[model samples]
Target: MSCSGMETVDELELVVERLMDAPVAAVWKAYTDHLNDWFCPPPWRAEVQVMELRAGGRALVTMYGPDGEVVPNDGVYLEVIPERKIVFTDAFQAGWKPAGPFMVGIFEFEPQGDKTLYRGRARHWTKDALEQHKTMGFEAGWGKVAEQWEAVAKRLA
Candidate 1:
């Protein structure tokens, strides 16, 4: 669907837009400061090994499951707008080193009256990867994370 003469990208997957009951500044703080607390779904946990929070800065995260499974993710911040947006990709590591591309994640926060509109999108490298991610429960997982994020934001507010 096209709106205002602009077409949405077809390659975007796991896109989620939610209205949070907090201001953008609070939400941003929750996202950046307490990421390890709400980044993963239930029964799983996130550990932020490193987060630089700037363009070309590093973000190394590891997710651990209840059963002790660990998944490492290393990425660089492509863009960062204070209290507004963040774009990161696993396509390149810190210092502009090329790595195996998995997904590019974009998160946007908008001021909506007394609340904030949170939008999230994950861009996959291939259709198969997209399908695989969907099958792996992207909605449920990301939705849970979003709920957790909102809770943190509201608490911070």
Candidate 2:
């Protein structure tokens, strides 16, 4: 799962990587089964309404802010490799129906002895979309989520 020397197109992608102190299996389980526990940053919680792990399956989550703000994320899984990788996008809905796309999200869990190297990439369709995501606190927000995920994974270990 080493993406060493892979040149990133800054105009289209944003990434967050972390070396977690938990095994790949634990990390994967935490992500797949306990997503709502660590998906959003503090004061904001996520609810996994529908998370079908297979390709073309629905991946719907509703995020709730402490102040009562609600945001729903509706997408379909593009790829799923147990304990290894997950690729999803909003480009299509259930049954392969086309829809307005935002960005493709890729999450990788690489085994490293007793630890896991987690990489998350968000690829946007355009530079503008990428910029918009950056403006929306992609770095800090995702970074916090990564930390939260690591904590949950550690607990699973």
Candidate 3:
């Protein structure tokens, strides 16, 4: 809880970050793989439909709701720098085919000595979607996922 070291994102990018007591490589693997189904806490299965870890790759994630409902989160890989950065988006599907894009996800990993600094940013296209995501309890939801990510990362560490 030593947030005195916390860094703020500029107004342009709208990024949110958190520190995890795990190594960079381990944390990267957990996110790259389908750890969500096991690590993400209750009312959420954290299922991964597909994940291809390379440029032009695709990842299909379904966030399961409390009552067995599914929300599709599809993204294509834009940049991949091992143990450092991953940039992807549901802005378009495979083949750059447009499908009324909604959001962009950027994950940047910085080495914090033995620990890792994880930056999770989701930039929605509009204020309404951002608001809807907040209404959906993004802080709680993503925060849990980060907690889950930490567990997985620690195991790998």
Candidate 4:
């Protein structure tokens, strides 16, 4: 992992950033409180099977397709920094059980005036995996989710 000022760039990382027109608290609330409402892009929905917001807690989720197909995501919360950051990984599950290596996501909210700078980074174990995720619409999908989150935050504001 390499950090340049407030930005980070790694060897095999996919990152998306946006300057949202909402406060940090509002953005954080949209994540912690209204995740299911905006976690997935439109036509797709997400269900949080289990989410304990503390460090080493569970973050099991499932994404349902428009036609009723489901995809399970087993992950753990690695670090939680209040309204600042959240680090989660699919390489391990609840109770620290090792699973197949996948993406480790880092979501950060930096206060900017009355708004927030939202950055989402997905690190993969291999370049191939990173490429695969890029091909899977990681940018568009995650960007959509962030946009939805900002809309929720604006509504809350």
Candidate 5:
């Protein structure tokens, strides 16, 4: 989708969007389910462990790259608004173990008539960090995950 001067801004200011093939509720569930089979990017698999759905709740999401190479990406829940929005940060793991500096993430669902305006935003610490993520194929990686999510959402919608 093209920019419409209506984009929301945040820390590192990274945003991605998709028109989900499924309904808003299904898409929202995919966003909340850390163990979702569709959360990982293409060519990689994921193992998720979601503890709760509230502020300070923990979620452990381990992404496995090619050949079962695992990279753990867990975080703490900052806020969750049912089927509308979710806020989390990469500050801790499932067991409340201290980890990396916080990277705030916001996922919002905007219903457009019969479609869902699915969006994801993540704020990194520095410009260099954001640039580093871009260089790592952020768009392509996340796009793939969105596609997977759409498929799952449609099936379960």
Candidate 6:
């Protein structure tokens, strides 16, 4: 349940990968510094309340839906590899205190010439959770967010 550098569990994970038209550095900067600008898809917006960006640091954000719905996510970073990878989960808080876990999120950005290969994954603790994520439109939602992230990276490039 620590999920630090854990391998993907096919039955409990959903992923979104993209070949972005931007450099790794730019992509990383956008992700680390401008998360609120691209973390959510259109009709929704995200505000990063805290993003310490180091192992055990806090990763908190509030997402707002167009219809006035607010979703606040609070988590801690499990690992951070600069421009390479980021792993976080709500399983633990900033002091490693156990919480009600939903999933572990892993995001990787690989350098590919002037472009970057980005992969985002959500690993759930149970099959029911995974099913719930699927029912919530995980693929389409994450895919749209990826596209938005890529655009932000491109602008940063």
Best by lDDT: 2
Clashes of each: 0, 0, 0, 0, 0, 0
Q: What overall lDDT goes with each candidate model?
A: 0.84, 0.88, 0.73, 0.86, 0.72, 0.87
What does candidate 5's lDDT look like per residue over 1-157, in tens digits?
Answer: 3222213265476777887767788777666663357877767888775557788888667877898688877788888888788888886665677777536788788876655777878778887777777778767776777778777777667
Residue 124 alpha-carbon offset, candidate 5, angstroms: 1.1
RMSD of each: 4.4, 3.1, 2.7, 4.1, 3.2, 5.3
For 1-157, candidate 2 gives per-residue lDDT tens digits of: 2222222557688888888888999999898889999999989999999999999899999999999999989889999999999999989878888888989999988899999988889999998888888889888888788888988999999
- lDDT sort, best first: 2, 6, 4, 1, 3, 5
TM-score of each: 0.91, 0.92, 0.85, 0.92, 0.84, 0.92
Check candidate 4 and list the clashing pairs. none
Error of 1 at 56 (Å): 0.4
Which of the predicted structures, 1 or 6, would earn the higher lDDT when compared with the native?
6
Superposed model 6: Cα runs more than 4 Å off: 1-9
Q: Which stretches of candidate 1 lie over 4 Å from their true place?
A: 1-9
Candidate 1 lDDT over 36-135, as tens digits, reads 8899987889999999999989999999999989998999999999999999999998788999887899998889987898878888988887888787
For residue 141, give model 2's deviation from the true position in Å: 0.9
Per-residue lDDT for 36-149 in model 4, tens only? 999999799998889899889999889999998898899899999999999999999888899997789999999998888888999999988888888888878888888888
Off by over 4 Å in 5: 1-11, 32-35, 94-98
Model 3 over residues 116-153: C-alpha lDDT tens digits?
Answer: 88877777777777767666766666667777787788
Better of 4 and 5 by lDDT: 4
Write down the lDDT that model 5 would get: 0.72
Work out how many backbone clashes candidate 4 has: 0
